[model samples]
Structures are given as structure tokens and as C-alpha cells.
Target: MNEILTKERLIEARERISNQVKRTPILTSSSINKILNANIFFKCENFQKVGAFKFRGASNAVLSLNEKEMINGVATHSSGNHAAALALAAKMKNIPAYIVMPKTAPEIKKKAVAGYGAKIIFCEPTLKAREETLNNVIQETNAIFIHPYDNYDVIAGQSTAAQEIFAELNDLDFIIAPVGGGGLLSGTALSTKYFSPKTKIIGAEPKEADDAFKSFNDKKIYPSINPKTICDGLLTQLSEKTFKIITNTVDEILTAKEETIIEAMKLIWERMKIIIEPSSAVTLAIMIENQEKFLNKKIAIILSGGNVDLKNLPFK
Candidate 1:
């Protein structure tokens, strides 16, 4: 399979997911919508069990794995939600799970993975470290490798979020998703293109990590591994496959600064009464900062995840 996701496989993934992971609420907030002159819908994946949509991909990947591969188990390196999701999903299937995470990753996240009974491997904060460590684990156990955002199957799984969001509000004029490595954005774009052709898909990224925006604008692939952003969840450089889909389907990329992200966190707390990590807050910042553009349009923003460390409120 190709590294990037395709429209056909995204459709197949939507069909293959059998159970309701969660019918997360699609809240219509006319206030923000009206202020921007855009009708806004928030897909509350924060309310999900693990408080993130990573569960969709983890669960799908676990179920779809070949029996032999399932027996050998699965492994991946993720900072937080994805690790917890993989561990829990594998547990549900009665398979072992191995997670690799940077030592600097939040202790809360590490605890979550351990709590789910996964062996946690700590590594340095670099792509080379993550890949080399993951490779060793794979070779030793013969575990199937499930990439966080790079693989076609993973992207197809993430697309399930878009399927749910659009299913909840079929007439949205556009969709906005947090673009870390572009898994969610690519998946959503492919699915939206197939299922809701009229709906425009836009990606939201931090100004500090503007490779997606720059790459799209420059019409060239810009590679940056471990680019610095308050959105640790958005730190992964886009995969080659995900980059292609975002380049093709996403209409525009919105950039928000670290300060705007802090304000966005405060807004979600005060108005929405939801806790979101800095990564998710970046997307909200985009909406508020560019209110004039989003205003009065039928729009949906995937509140991707709520995995912030409670002690790090306001992101230090």
C-alpha cells in the first residue's frame, strides 16, 4: 500500500468500522458561528473515552490486523493519546501492545500507557531515535508496526472521525482539522471529497510549525522533523502520503501563534467548558483569529483531543 492515503481506502475504512466507538456530539454554537458569519459545528472527540479520536484508528487497526500479526502484537511511538489508545485497544482484543515514547513526554501520558498494561520504551526526542527504537522492538517481537500518521491503514482509520463528523452534520460547508502530521486532515479531506464533495477541507497548524502552510503555498514539499510547536501533538512532520492528500484536497491552511493558542485554551475552558491540549487549542485559535473568514459559513472543526496534563494548564 502507498504511504499516503487514497480516497477509495478511506471509504472502505468507514464501511469496515463495525461498532460505535462513540457518537460524539456535534455541537452547533451559533455564537461563534454568527460572530464569524459562519455556522460552526464542533465535533467533540474530547468527550471520547480516552478523550481523543486516536481511539478510532487504534481500535480499527487492532481489529483489522491479521491473526498472526495480532498474536505477535503491535507497536508504535506516540507522545500521548495514541500510545494510550493503542495500549487500551490491544488490551480489548487480548493482544499485547508495545509503545515507544520520548522521555520528555508527559508523565501522565506514560502512566496511561502503563496503566493499560503496555511495555513503554523511552527514547530521545528525535525521529531517528523513535524509528531505531521501534525497529528494534519490531525485530525482536515480530510485532506488526502501526504507524501513528504515516501508513495508509492508519490514515484510513483516522478518516473514521470525518465519517462520524459529517454523518452528524451532513450539510457542513467546510471542515477544519488540526494538522499535526496531517493524518486527521488527510483522512478527513479524502472522505469529505468522496462523501461530501461540496464541503471544503482546511488544515489548522501552529505558526511555529508552518511547514504544511509553507509547503502548500510554495507548491513544494518542505520537510521538518520534530519542528518546535506548543502543539506537541502536532510535532510529527507530515508523512509523504498525508502531505500529498492535504496538498490535493485541503483548500487552505490556517496558522495560529503560541499566544493565540493560549487564549484559545482559555476560551474553550470558559465558553465550551472542555479541557483541550495545546494542540487542539491551536485549531480553535485559528477559528477565533480568522473569525471574519469562518463567519456565517456552515463549518465544522474537529476538537481533535483533550489530553493536556492538568498541572500544565495554560501550557507554561
Candidate 2:
């Protein structure tokens, strides 16, 4: 079925974006495996185009458009990776991309999105500012809005990462991924359950930005305004569609300290030589902090993204 939000749509997105996106490698790390007392498989989405898996969802959404939609162009708001991905995807498809970004978004991300030929609209760091900016642009150009994570097509495209990971490592007892706006987590939960119903799904959220965690417990997902966290990406509230999936499919919501995130990032970089952003490293932080709980189990973790600034390396 071509219906929106259907499992078939996710499967279709997996098939449609395969050519543009990498089936990012699933790696087994001896160091991590030894420490966790479990078999660990790393789904390295950092190796994806644009230094993150955001490219997959954004590209799929942009490229699946009809000629009419393409002509109207695509508009979106992102702190960084999604903007760059959307910009690059639209450029590749010969469509104009309009990106609204928080003024405080990293300079590197801004430059990368601009470099991809997307027109940029700078806004305050509030969701209100972003939505307003996006609306103005859409009204002016009649562009189709490609939300960063809320859209079904985007979630479906993001789910493909798990499809690839589970395909390679079918015996995983659990799959752990970092949650930010719940795109990856929602996609992961749906896809993982669809393929291996027995595999437990868990999401790692920053303690500082624990909306999803609180939402899970309270049974009502609440949207917060600019929650403080070093995991910059994990600041938004869970979407309605996303919260429903997590409520039903996710076995648990895990949290990790900001300091633990830094430590985890360092360990992966120094020990395994794999670079992961603090946001991405939160999953490892969860595993490290909750070590005894995961003993002897096989786990799959998504190394979500690697867009950390080099000058901002952890203090040794």
C-alpha cells in the first residue's frame, strides 16, 4: 500500500533510497565486546553521505517527489545534518531547497548547507521561530515542507538503517539507538519489530533532555522549549506518531549523563578509532552505565551521526 505511515511505505522507502544512501557497515568491535560482556554490533551511520544518516531520510523524501512537487521545491528547518542532507538531495534532483536554521546552529553546518546550494533563512533558536520562518517561505514559494523528523516518509527512510543492520546481524537480542525528535528511534522500533518481533527495542535519551523518557513514564509526551543538553539534537519533544510507536514497541527508555556521553565518545574514538558525536555516543553511554543489565546479550547500536567539531574534543 502507498498509504502514508503504513509499514509498506517504510519498506518502499528502504527500496527507493538504497541507491542514494549507504547500507552503512555493521562492525564488530573486539574492545567494546570485551568490555560489555556482550556481542556488540555497531551500525555506523556516520560513514553515510553527509557524515550522518539524516541524508537517507532527507534524500528519500526529496527524490520521491513528482515533477510538480519538484518544481515547487522542498523546504525544511534543521540545526545541521538534516539541512545539509536536504540541501544536497534537492540539489542532486535539480530542485531548489529552502532551509530555516536556528541562528546559533554551528557555523560548519550552516556552511555545509549553503555549500549544497540551498537558500538559507536564519531564525531564533525557538521552534516558534523555525515554524514561522518555514511558513513564510512556503507561502512565498508554494514549496512542499519536508519536516525534519515528523513525516512518515522520513521515518520510513530512517528505518532502513535498522533493516541493513539486522540483515547482517540477525541474532541481536536488542537494538539500542539514541533518540532525538524520535525519528531514528521510531523508525528503528517499527522496522526492528517488523523483522524480528522478539528483539527488544530501547531508546537512549540524554538526562538533561529527558522529554521522551518522562513522556514514556507519564503516558503523555510533552514538548519543551530549548531543553538544555550537550546532546544538541535531543532537544525536541516526541511526535504523536513517534510516541505511539515507542509506547507500544519500545521496551524501555534509557538515559545517560552528559559527562558519560563525552567519555563514551572518547572511548570509541581512541579505542575503536570510530568518530561519533556526543549525541550519537549517548547510546554507548547508556550501555556503559547500565553494563550489568546487558551482560551476555547480543546488542545492535546505531552510531547515529559524527558531526562533532574537532576543536571541541573531550578534555583528557
Candidate 3:
């Protein structure tokens, strides 16, 4: 297989976005560790700018553009996090950003994207509609299309989160990340391979939105159709580029039930006193569901984002 990214590329991406992206904290809950019989470290990307790790990739994509590419600005279609991240990244560069969002996206995310000064175009809640809408926006504005997860630079940028983890900790047996379009998971897999070869990279997802899990097992790309998961951030299917990287580097893909995801999310909120969206909780859900596999192991979980609608939480 052709190499889509290199260790140098990830290092470069970290340096490129270092000034813009936050080095989010690594948090651990002793009580939770005792309960699970594992040493779990949470790479709290929920505390990241735009409240998601998407900011790293978005910043890298926007900053990688040259003068000509920046002329028309950047454009993308996202259910939530990526839209807000790209909007803020473009705004920082004093350029315009056009975002195509599903009408069903959380109101908080819609407001966040608009607050970042991006022009939002609402479309049907389907990948086809999102792609068609984004294409039209790009044609009309001549903007560069920065895909949410398919681009190499975006994947490289996402790898920095795992790189950060390796910097602070060593000999971690496994690293888990929630897989949506596979951007963060692919990046984490690459980082694990380069920085700590002994570490295994696992991708976690909601069973309701298990396209990535299915694709990984089948070795084929599958569309995410009518997925009914509360992890809104993980509703999208993986792109060819991300799928290729994931199939090659990722060690395993695991799925969590919807109720288990909610339980894990609530557990983190109560134990760590930190807010995490359902998407982030999928990692913990998998650990909770497969306790034997991770027993006494050192693990790192990437809390993908905290961009949930407060009034519409899954909990009572």
C-alpha cells in the first residue's frame, strides 16, 4: 500500500498548528480505573478549541493553503464539529468559510458555526445532500474543499493528539478513539505505529452507526445509511482515503450499544466532572463492555468532542 502520511508529516502538522491548537489535558479518574481494573488515560479533546479534535485537522488544512488557494477561502460539509472547526480556522486567517450542514444537526453546533462567522447552508440530513450542497457552494465561491477526514493533511493533523499522549506517557498497551469518518482514528493509528509500535490502536463506534466497524471487518467501504445513534458526531461514514489508512494501521474496531454509550458518558461526567459528548463515550463503552480484554492494561481514550446540546442530553 502507498503511504498516505509519514512520521515527518505528522510532526510538521503539529508544528504548523501548534500556535493555534490547544495541547489539551490528559485526565484520569482513579475511581473509574479501580472499577475497571485498568489504568485509563483520557486525552480530553473535548476541551480543545471548537470543543473537538477536529480543530487540529481544520487548522492544518486552512494553514497549508497558499495565497492562491486562500483567495476563495475554504468550504466543507459537516454534521457539526468539523464545520465549527473549519469556520474558526478560516476566520483566524481572515478568510471566508462556507459550511454545508445537515438541518438536523444540533442547534448548539449550528449556532457555534455561525458564531465563528462562517456562512451556513442547511441541507437534508443525508451524505448525498451534504455533498451536493458543498459542491454547489464550492462552485459558486471557488473555495477550496477541505474534506472533514479524507485529506492527508487532515489525517496528519489528527495524529498530533496521539503524539501528545506519547509525549506524556509511555508503554501504553492500547489507545482507543471513536471512529466517525476515521480521521482521528487513522491519525491515532499512525501515531501509535510511529511513536510506540508496541501500542495497539482500537477504533470504537456506536453499534447503531457501525459502518466503520462493518467496513473494517469486511475489508470493504460501506455507506452509513439511516444510522440511529445518539453519538451524533459519529454519524458519518468513512471515506476511501481514511478507510484505506484505517484498514492498514488500525488494530481493531469495536462497537458499543446506545444505552452503554449513555452510561459511559454519564460515568465520565460524574467521575471526572468533565463534560463529554456521547461520541467520546464510545471508547469507554467498549472498555466497559469488554472488560476482560482490557483488564490491567494501560489505555488511552480520545474524547473526540463535547459539542452536545445541553438541553437535549441523553440523560434524565
Candidate 4:
């Protein structure tokens, strides 16, 4: 009964973060539907606070903390939207936030995190360095560590995105999301399982960072090392909790080449008139790669984020 990954827990998370978070809109593209010969629904989380869905989980984690937990604030290591999200969420709670960022991270992301009043600590780009830096920050400040995608509260919070999708439209034949650390995909799979049992949960992964695809098929976790994909948000490997949920509930993991990802991202901007990060384009790329499977089906695509460094775009 105390399980945090259950439907009840997700529902509770929805209630908790409802007042603080925006209920992002769902958009449809007639042109894209014609191209794919399928009715595709896009849950646009790009419009979410901090320009990403990471805010939902971060806010949930921050808001869920007890009074004792709040006194020491929170700490996290992320070079993308998660850092900004956690920092902003902690600011909302009127508490201190310690953020560990790689020195090589984009200046935009660094600015976003600092703008939220978090104390930023620079570290080497490697995961080992980030973890070591974050550990030291936590040790020094006694801040609760809020992992980007590994915590149960974070997963439960992420599930609310799919809940909103089902609430608006429930006849989806397939629900697809990009798999980074498996938080969004696993959360989506659980939501689809409860709300639309017939819907297949599919994960879109970059071939350059295809650890999730490999792990899903191999039934084991694999390290993501020096990934050469433009999907910066998805460079991290899956956590044990995420891997377990994904293997159990997800129907499949499809991978897309770098070219396909860039092409899909450009197409969305041109057709849908929406800005999406490369990580978000992975889902559309998967649909394009496997057109036969998705043709004539009603599919839902979760656009993970819109946080892109405009100065460094993959497409012209």
C-alpha cells in the first residue's frame, strides 16, 4: 500500500503539483497526420514551466518534502532542464538549492539555474565528477538529493503528464515518449496501463545513445558513455527503478539515427510551428522509422521539452 509507483501515488502527485504547475496543452498537426497517415496527438510539455516537463517532478519533490526536510534545502547535479527546474522549485519553497553543473554545459542552462537563486558549483563534465561534486555539496549543506529521473517521487510526478493526455483523449492506440533515464517512458507506460490498457507504450531512443533500447531488449542496464547524440537531455543511463518499470510495462524501444532526429526536429518546427529540443524529436523519428506500425493508428507523442540552445541548432 506504500508503493510510490502506483496509480494512486501518481494521482496524489497530480493533486499536489496541480496548483503550482501549468497543465500544458495538447496540439495536433494536420500536416503531420497526412504525412504519417495517422492521427497523432502531441502533448506539448515545451510550454511547461522552465520550458520543460522536468519542472513537474522537481516541484513535486520539493513540495512533498516535510518541514524537517525543508530546513536543509535540496541538492542536484544536472546540466539541462532538471537543474533549472529544481532550482526554481526550491526558490518557490523559499529554500536554498545547491546545483552542480558541468563547466562545459551551455551558458543558457547555467544562466537559467543561477537565475533561480541556486548556488551553482562547477564540476568536470564526466558523471563521476558530477556525482562527486553533488555528494560534497549535499554533505556540506545537508540538502536532500533530488535525482533528475531516478527517484520514485520524480517518476510519480512525471506520470501526471500521461494522466493529462488520457484525461483529454483516451483512444490512443500507442503512447510514445523519448527514453532518457526512463522516467518519462516508465511513468507513461504505467499511466497507459491503467487508463488505456489497450494502448502500447513505446520508447523513442537515439541510436547514438541507444542504451535504453539495448537494455530493454537485453533485459539489463547498460552504461551510456560519451554519447554522441544531440539529445543532451537523454545522455544519461537508466536507473534501476526506471529499468525495472520500463522492462515490465513498456511494449518496445525504438531507436533513431542522428540524421533522422535532426530531420524530424526540423519537420516539427516547419509543420507544427512549435519549438522542440532534439530529445523531443526522437519520438517523431521513431514514428517515421516505423511508419507501417503507426499508420492509421491514433498515437500520442509526449514532447519532452523545448529547451534548446538556439545558437547551436542541429538543423539549418
Candidate 5:
């Protein structure tokens, strides 16, 4: 387990990126608590830099680079959040960033990355196309590829969000987070294990994009194939590093239907008065579905992002 990501490493990462990243607040809603019959605390990473928790890992990865590694700058392929995050983090360090984004990526995200001054390459909406385009960019620019969720540094950085949760709230019964590439989930698991070992780590995914759910139960990595869900951020499959970490540390993986996801997102918007993307609501949706498991329990949910395009609201 130490080989994957040590507690000491997580602490160091927190300190490393503390100055760069936002220490987002923990928020709660009485309406949500009464509706779910559980004490829920949300780590609002939506307020984080780049409007998502991805900035935490991106900042850490970019800042961890040595002078030699920083020479060629960094690159990554993301549908939105990570691309914008890496671009902004690189821009902060005055380094070039090359981003490969899917053509179908949200227009707001495309503009955000470009606004950060990163060179954006558009590709088909397939993981293969994104990776192929990224490879060509790396070959041409020799940029250091900072994988969205696969790298240990990125994972360590993501752990800090859970670390923050544990710092303010003690003895949580469970820490739930949305699972996409498993970067955030794996990192949350590690933080739970190290900071509050008794607290279980739960990963929530959309049923339409249940690769992480299937992979966790099967104890094998599964590619995300044609996932169709409103949670755009939860479409990526788990990598070997994140899969191993999640399987070892995560207590369970739960899934929510598309309708439930939308319902959850709408509930937060109306009740909490905060905007959250569909992916961020998966954790809450699972909680609503599995109310029995979490009834009267103290839970911490990571609101992973708030990068939704306002014009494309899912609510009626």
C-alpha cells in the first residue's frame, strides 16, 4: 500500500499544493439531511480553482516537476476539467500546456482551457482518439504527460480533499465520492484509510457508466465502453494504479440511475443553492437510493465539480 501512496506522501502533497489550491469549505443542508435522514457533509470542491477538484491534482503534478521536466512543459487529454486544470496550473508556473480534448466536450470547458492559454487539440469523443492525439502532441512537443488520474502524484494530490474532510469532521461513518477514472475515489480511499481508518470509503458511479462499479466487484480493470450518462466527468475507465488502490482500500462501489442522478443534481441546486454537475451528484444519488445503509450515519460527500454549462441545464 505504501508503494501506491503513503500517508506521508499525502501529507507532503497537501503542504506542497496548499498555497496553490483552494481550501474549499464543507457545507451542509438541513433539507437534504431531513430528506435523506442522514447527516451529510459536502466537501465543496466546486469552489476550487478551475471550479473542480482536478485543480488540486493538476497543481501538485505541475509543481512537482523538476527544472528539467519543466523545460518541455506538460500535456494531458481530458474531456474538460483536467484539461482546464492542467492548463491553468501550467500557466501559473509560466510553462506551456498542450491539451487534447474531445470535440464533444462542453463548450464552456473548451473556452476555459483556451482561456488559460493552453494549446487545445480537438479529437473525436473516444478515449482512443484522445490518446492518439495526445501521443502525437507529446511526440512533437516532448511535453511531460501528466495523466489525469493514473499518476501517483496526481493521486496523492487528490487525497488532500479527503484529508480536509477528516480534519474538520471526525468519526465519519463513510466518505463517499464519485468515481470516474478513480483518481478522486482512490485518493479518497487512501485518505480515509490513513486519516480515519474506521470510516468506510464508498465510490458512486452512474449505472450508465458503471465500469468502476464492475471493475471494483470483479477485482479487474474494465474499459469504459460507450457510457451514456449525464455525468460527463464519470465516463473514463479505471487505470491499473487506481484500480488496485480502489480495490484494496475502497469498502464498496455503488451506482445510480440517470434519472436519480439528475434528481440529485436538481435537489442540490434547489436546496443547497449551489450548482453542481451531474458527476458530482452520483454520491448523493447513491445515498438516496441506499438510504438504509446510511440512515442516521455521519457521511462526507465530495462535490467533485461545478463545471456544468448553464445553457445545457438538465433540469426541466
Candidate 6:
């Protein structure tokens, strides 16, 4: 097939980073299945290295760079998991990583990034400010800018999660993942299409951050402005590359309300005894919202991450 990403690329990524990243487990909850009336599998990326699936992408991006590119190291702007993932990946490769984070970022996340030995530059929380700060860091260090979700290497790396899911369960009727900058969702779409052509790929998002949904329906990329959602990982808008992949491959974008997301998060904690972030809960919220459509079907949900700050939880 004529595609920007290929099965060979994803296979290469998995081989390259096999020793570097973890093949997180796939979990099934009988209670959850009974509640939704669908056979559901949860690809627990929360158990992934660096506590999120971002590690897979970061490891691939860092490892793909040659010695010359490694000299100056890599840099990116992120307030949460990506920063930590890139920093840890760079450390594993014995290279430097520069991360630009907003000063208002949660203390736990800031600490995690710094703990990985990345040099952190703080800026305002706005996109313009983050971009300006990241650009400045790049200029000063001459580091390669490894965008969190836009780069082909990163997408290929992220696809491995969905690839694993399909490998473990070939009969999934639908594979759902949360959409932020559309990295995970786009990667899932690509891998789902390649590995299990019969399975539909769905992108889930918080209603508060429904840029992907709007973009899907409008047939164009749309930006999220001042998104006020508990799912911090899904606040960013999609990149051009991700937008293209989502538009071409994703079957639909489902949005969940804030209450639904929180409730789903709580349910997972209560029943599955897993701590998933609000972004991960978006997938379950979408399924719960459209129960009848998925009833009795086999579905797989990508639990994107578990990096929520317990101190600032959405649920009481």
C-alpha cells in the first residue's frame, strides 16, 4: 500500500528498541466487560517505560539519530510524559536532552523530567511561549528538534503498542486510543490497518479538547485554544503529519464529557485496580457513551499513560 508509514518501518522500530523499551502487558477486566457488554482488552501502556507510551517514540527517535546528530543531542517542548521519555531515552544513549516546559507544569512532571537529567527551560504555558523557548534552546544547543508526535520515527515507534495488541488479539473489532497531538491515535490507525485490516481504528478525546473530532468532521486540521480538560495529555492540537494520517485512516473520533472521563477513570481504579490518567480514561468514556454500538464486540483500548498527579486529581 502507498502510505507514509509501512509495516516494515514499525517492525524495524520494534527490533531496534526491543532491548530498550518494555512490551507492556495486555489486561482484560471481566467486570468492565460485563458493564459495557463488550469483550474489551486494555493495552496497559501506563506500565510502559517512563510510565507512559511516549518512551517508545522517544527511544526510537533518539536511537535513529546517527553519531553526528547525537553530538548536539535532541530537544523538545513538553510539560509531561514526553519530556521525561526523551530525557531517559537520551540518557540511555549517553547523549544530552534539552526539555522546555512551562513553569506552571505540575511539580511531579517537572521533577520527573529533571530526574531524567534533561536540562529544563521554563516558559509561559501558551503555545507561542513554549515554541519560542524551545526554539531558543535549539538555537543555543544546535540540538535536533524531536517533535513529540509529528516525526515519522516517533510515529513508527508509537505504532508498536497497537502492533502488540493486534499480535496478541487478532480479532479485535475496534481499537481505540486517546488523541492529543494525534500521535498515539495516528500510530494506532496505521498499525491497525496494517496488522488487522478488519479492525476499525477510533480516536477518543475529551469533549473539552475535541480538536481531533472537529478536524475529523470538518476534513481539516483545527487548533485547540484554551482547552480546559482534566486530560492534560490531550490538550495539544494535531500536527500536519498526524492530521493527514488521521484523516486518511481513522474511522472516527469520539469525544467524551468531563464527567464521563472522570467516572471512567474511577471505575478503572476501582475495578481493574489500575491507575490511568484522565487521557487514558477517554477511550473507556467513549465506549461507555456508545455502548450499544460496541455491545458484544471485541474491542481494545490503549490506556495511554498513568502520569496523573495524585494531589491534583479530578475526582475527590
How does each model score on TM-score? Answer: 0.92, 0.96, 0.97, 0.98, 0.97, 0.98
The residue-by-residue lDDT of candidate 1 on 31-148, one tens digit each, is 5555456677788888876888888778778877878779999999887788888898888888889898988986788888999999999999877899999999999988888888
Q: What digit string (tens of lDDT, one per residue) describes model 3 on residues 1-316?
A: 2365888888899999999999999999999999899999999999999999999999999999999999999999986788899999999999999999889987777888999999999999877898899999998999999999999989988999999999999999999999999999999999999999999899999999999999999999999989999988898899999999999989999999999999999999999999999999999999999999999999999999887777788887
Task: Report the alpha-carbon TM-score of model 5 versus the true structure.
Answer: 0.97
TM-score-superior candidate, 2 or 3: 3
TM-score of 3: 0.97
Which stretches in model 6 have alpha-carbon errors above 4 Å? Answer: none
Error of 2 at 234 (Å): 1.2
Looking at model 2, report the run of 10 residues with the lowest lDDT sum.
Answer: 1-10
**Can you write out model 5's per-residue Cα lDDT over 2-64, one digit (the tens) per residue?**
575889999999999999899999999999999999999999999999999999999999999
Q: Which residue segments of model 4 deviate by more than 4 Å?
A: 1-3
Superposed by TM-score, candidate 1 places the C-alpha of residue 306 at a distance from the truth, in angstroms, of 0.5
- Alpha-carbon lDDT, every model: 0.80, 0.86, 0.93, 0.91, 0.93, 0.91
* TM-score between model 2 and native: 0.96
**Better model by TM-score, 2 or 6?**
6
Candidate 6 is scored at a TM of 0.98
Residues 33-129 of candidate 2: C-alpha lDDT, one tens digit per residue: 8877988888999999898888988988987888987898999988768888899889988899999999998888889999999999999987789
Which regions of candidate 2 fall more than 4 Å away from where they truly are?
A: 1-4
Q: For residues 188-273, what per-residue lDDT tens digits would candidate 6 score against the true structure?
A: 89898889999988999999988889999999888898899989899889999999998999999999999999999999999999
